[model samples]
Every structure is written in C-alpha cells, then in structure tokens.
Target: MAISSAVQGVSTAKRQRFLRSTVVLHAAAAVTGLVMVLYLLAHMYGNYKVFSGQVAFDGYSHYLRTMGEPLLPRTGALWIIRVVLLASVLIHMYAVIALWRRMRKATAGKGGRRYQSRKNPRGVQRTYSSFTMRWGGIIIFLFVIYHILHLTVNAIAPGGASESPYERVVNGFSIWWVVATYVIAMLALGFHLRHGFWSALASLGANTSPARRRLFNQTATVLAVVITVGFLIPPVAILFRGVGS
Candidate 1:
C-alpha cells in the first residue's frame, strides 16, 4: 500500500507539471508563430525585387537599410525587430521540444484510437496538416542551411563571386537547380504556414469552437496560397527572363 501510494503521488505530480508546461509552450508557440510569419513575408517581398535583375534587387535591399528616408542613420527599428525574432524563434523551438517530451511520457503505453493508429502509426494520430508539417519543417531547415552558405556565407557560386550582395545573389540564382530549390522550398513553406498560422491562433484562444477552428483553418489556407504566390511570382518571372542563366 505504501509503494502504491508513492507511485500514485508521483503520477499526479507529473500530470500537474505537464499541464503547466503545456500552457507555457502553447503561449510561446502563438507569439513566435505570428512574428515569424510577418518576418517571412517581409523577407520574401524583399527577395521578389530580384525579378528586376541583380542591380535593381540589390538596390532595393540597400534602400531597405535606409527605410526609404534617404538618411545617413540606417533604420535601427528593422534590426531590432530581427533580433527579437531570432530570440523568439529560439524560445519557441525550446518550448515545442519540452512539450513534445511531456506528451510522449504522458501517452506512453496508451493505444491510440483505431483510426488514428492507422493514419499515424508514429503518433496518436496524424492529421493531414501534421503529415506535411514535419516535411515542410525539414525542407525549411535544409533551405535555411543552404541559404546561409549561398547568401549568408558567400560560398562558391556560378560565378567566382566576391561577397558583394549583388555578385553573390546574381551568381547564386544563376543556376537552374538553385532556382528550382527556391521554388520547392517556398512550396513547403506554404504547407507549413498553412497549418501553423491557424493553429497558432487557435492555441491562443482565438478560435474556441470546432466551427471557428474550421473557419480559421480556411483563412490560414488562403493566407498560405497568398504567401506561395507572393514568393513564387518573382522567381518564376526571373526564371522565364533567363536573368540568372
């Protein structure tokens, strides 16, 4: 009886701790998700300037530094936002990992529902969105790595390039394969954003009911389509123009 009581006490404590952790993770997820979406959209818009060729695009980026004020002091606000975003992303991922471990522990030995097991043998169940979320995250991670090398690290490119943003970018996208990868990455981003955006709102208590969740899901779907189109248009135009080629 004494041993049984001790085990039950531990279990209850674990459950309570998990509930608190879940709340924290969900909150972080909501905040980070919103900020990241905005950051991505801005980044994509800047990249779209590449459609006008290297000079135009590079100039656009240079102009962004000035915040269109034509001033000596660059916009500190932009850099501040970027810093905050980086910090938020770190916190968000940490929370997600914490919650994931807690979930695994809580669900251990529980047989999932039959339909869920069939759909997602890996988890309690796989929602359609869940399947793509993992894939999309993978693509994004890969792209971020390559992107740093090409754009960030100034790695080798089609042209023996200097680190000049202009030289680097023009040389970077000059390859068909590179451009193709950009397209694929943007598509994956669309999938990930589709589920993430709405789900974030839902996590934050924006959509309380099943019907509301469905409505928000449709909204997120539309936003995803917009983001995909917004990203693809400039690249597709550049590809057709053979600017990089």
Candidate 2:
C-alpha cells in the first residue's frame, strides 16, 4: 500500500508538471500569434500603397529596406523585423503543434475517435472557423512560402521576373490562375484569423465574461474581414481593372 501511494504521488507530480508546461506553451502561442497579427496589419497597409502607382509602391518597399539608415545599415532594420517574425512563426507553430498533440492524445480512445457530445448534433461544438483552423493554417503556410518566392525573392515569378516590386505585383496578379490561387489563400487566412484571434485571446486569459467573449468574437470577425478584403483588393483590381497596368 505504501509503495502504491508513492507511485501514485509521482504520477500526480508528473501530471502537474505536464499541465504547467502546457500552460506555458499556450502563452507562447498566444503572444507569438498576436505579434504576427500586428505584422500582418502593417503589411496590409504597405500593400495598399500599390494603388498609389509603381513609383510609390516600389519607394515604399525601398523605405522598408532603408528604414533605420545612419542608426543602422541599409536593410538592417528589415532583417531585424524578418528575424523577429521568423522566430515568432517558429515558436507559434511549435506551441500549437505541441498543444494539438496533447489534445489528440487526451482524446485518443474508443477507436481513436474524439468524444461525441449529445448537446450538439455534429458531436462537437465547433464553429466553421474553428473547424477549418488546421487546414486553413496549412493553406496559409504554403501560400506564405509561395508569396515570398514570387514577390520578395523574385525567384518563382508566375508571369515574369522583375527587379521592381511593383512590376512583380502587377505581373503576378495579372495572371488569372495566380489571382485565383491568391483568392483561395486569402479566404483560408480569413477563416484562420477569425478563429485564431479569438482563440489566442482566450489562451491569454482575455475571455473573462460573456460580454468580453462577444466583443472578442466581433473584433476577430471584423479584423478577419478587413484584412482579407484589404489583401484581395489589389490583386483583384490588378487582374480585372488593370490598376497597375
């Protein structure tokens, strides 16, 4: 009996440590997700400058690269931002994957199926945004790599390669398939952001009341719509209206 008690105590202690680590991962994911959201807003604003014409758009790109001249070398500030964003992306992905694995493990049983709730006909209380979160994240991840290659790196231009960022935007989006791909990716991002924003806030302990929950939900929806629309406009305009042409 004494040996069994000691073994049980050790198990309990291990469970406590596991729970604490999970909490830390949640916090890390929340913080990093928020950081990326801020970056997205800024990036969306920069993208809007494309409507100002090629010179203005390319100038904006140059401004980003030379942001901290004198105080820092050319592209130094940009590199700093890149490093921060990369670190945030890595940490956020790691935390999310770890938490997801824990959730799957906890739910693993009864033929490795998730729990069925009688309260909901679908077996789980899941919003469309939440339900699509994992797949949407995958789409967004793949699109980001393609976006960097097409525009930033000038390595995989769909229409044609160009030194000018403005030309890259106009050239790429001018293609029908390219625009379609972008639209699909943006829609996925919208869904991801809708759920992720609210989830991140909740993870950070912001969903304290029903009122706060409603507000966060509304805010998440608005942000998702705005960011999605904001990104889509330039590409759609370039494709159909010849905004850059």
Candidate 3:
C-alpha cells in the first residue's frame, strides 16, 4: 500500500509539472508566432515597392542592409533581425514538439485505441487545421529556402541576376513555373496563417470573452487575406511584366 501510494504521489507531481511546462511553452510559441506575423506584414509592404520602379525597389533593399547607419556596421541590423527570428523559430519548434508529445501521451493514457470517431464542429476544425498544418509548414519552409536561393544568393537565377536586386526579382518571376509555385506557396501560407493566428491568440488567453473571440477571429481572417494578397501581387505583376518601367 505504501509503495503504491508513493508511486502515485510522484506521478501526480510529474503530471502537474508537465502541465505547467506545456502552458509556458505554448505561450512562448504564440508570442514568437506573432512576431513572425508582424515581420511578414512589413516584408510584404517592402515587396510592394517593386511597383515604384527599379531604383526605388533596389534602394529599399540597400536600406535594409544599411539600416542603422554609422551607429551600426553594414548589415548589422539585418543580422540582428535574422538572429532574433532564428531563435524564435527554434523555440517555436520545440514548443510544438513538446505539446504534440504531451497530447499523444494523454490520448494513450485514456486506454483508447488509435482510431476513435467523434464529430464536433470545433473538433472538426481542429482536425482539418492539424492535417493541413503539417504539410503547409513543410511547403512554406521549402518555399523560404527556394526564395532565398532564387533572390538573395542569385545562385539559381533563370534569367540571370545582375548587380540590381530588382532585376533578380523580375527575372525569377518571369519564369512561368516560378510564379505558379509562388502562388501555390502563398496559398499554403494563407491557410496556415488563418488557423495559426487564431490559435496563437487563444494560447495567449486573449479569447476569454465572446466579444474578444469574435474580434480575434475577424482580425486573423483579415490578416491572412491581406498578407496573401499583398505577397501575391508583386510576383504576379512581375511575371506579367505589369509593374514598373
């Protein structure tokens, strides 16, 4: 009796610790995701500069590299931003893995088989989002790598990347498949953002009231659409040769 009681006590304590850890991790991931969303919005606006002509667009790129002027070295501010974003990505991934493990353990602990069919609206939304998220994340991740390779490094340029950043963008989008892939990736990003933004707010405890929940949902939807359209415009315009002189 004493041995079993002691074991139970220890297990209970461990469970409590796990719950607290999960909460903290979820909150951290939510905050990091929010930061990334803000960055995406700013990046989308910068991308829109392509419509102003090559000089304006390339000047914007140069400004990013020399942001802080004499107070910071060349690319110093950009590097700082990169490091912060990298840290956020690591933390967010760790939190995701931890929460997933915890959820699996919980399901197994209930003595249920792998397949149980329960149909509820919220549950269905969750199921759909979870299914889409894994693949959507992979797509977005690959797109990011390809985007950096195509534009930033000028390594795989189809029409050649000259000294001008504007030329690289135009050259890349000039390819039919490139624009198609970009559009597809942006669609995936839109889906991911639609679910992720709302969930992040929920994780941060911002949906306590019905009014707040409504506002959060609306904001998330608006943001997702805005970002998707904002990013798609420049690529589509470049592909069609519809923008700039």
Scored by TM-score, the top model is: 2
Weakest 10 consecutive residues of candidate 2 by summed lDDT: 109-118
What is the C-alpha lDDT profile of model 1 across 54-154, one tens digit per residue? 67877876666677354435866556776898788787777766766766677793523344355566545645665577578778878887887777567
What is the alpha-carbon lDDT of model 2 when measured against the actual structure?
A: 0.91
- TM-score of model number 1: 0.75
Per-residue lDDT, model 1, residue 117, is 59
Lowest summed lDDT across 10 adjacent residues in model 3 is found at 109-118
Task: List candidate 2 stretches off by more than 4 Å.
Answer: 1-20, 109-119
Candidate 1 vs 3: which has more TM-score? 3
lDDT of 1: 0.75
lDDT of each residue in 1-245, candidate 2, tens digit only: 99999999999999878755988899988899999999999999999898999899999999999999989999999999999999999998898888888887877832224457776755566779988987898999999999998999888988788899999999889999999999999999999999999999999999999999999999999999999999999999999965976
Q: What lDDT tens digits, residue by residue, belong to model 3 across residues 87-204?
A: 8878877887677677779888442234334555333335355458668888988998898888877778876768789988888788889999999999989888888899899998
Regions of model 1 farther than 4 Å from truth: 1-20, 68-75, 109-125, 156-167, 242-245
Q: Cα deviation in Å at residue 76, candidate 1?
A: 3.6
Model 3 — TM-score against the truth?
0.84
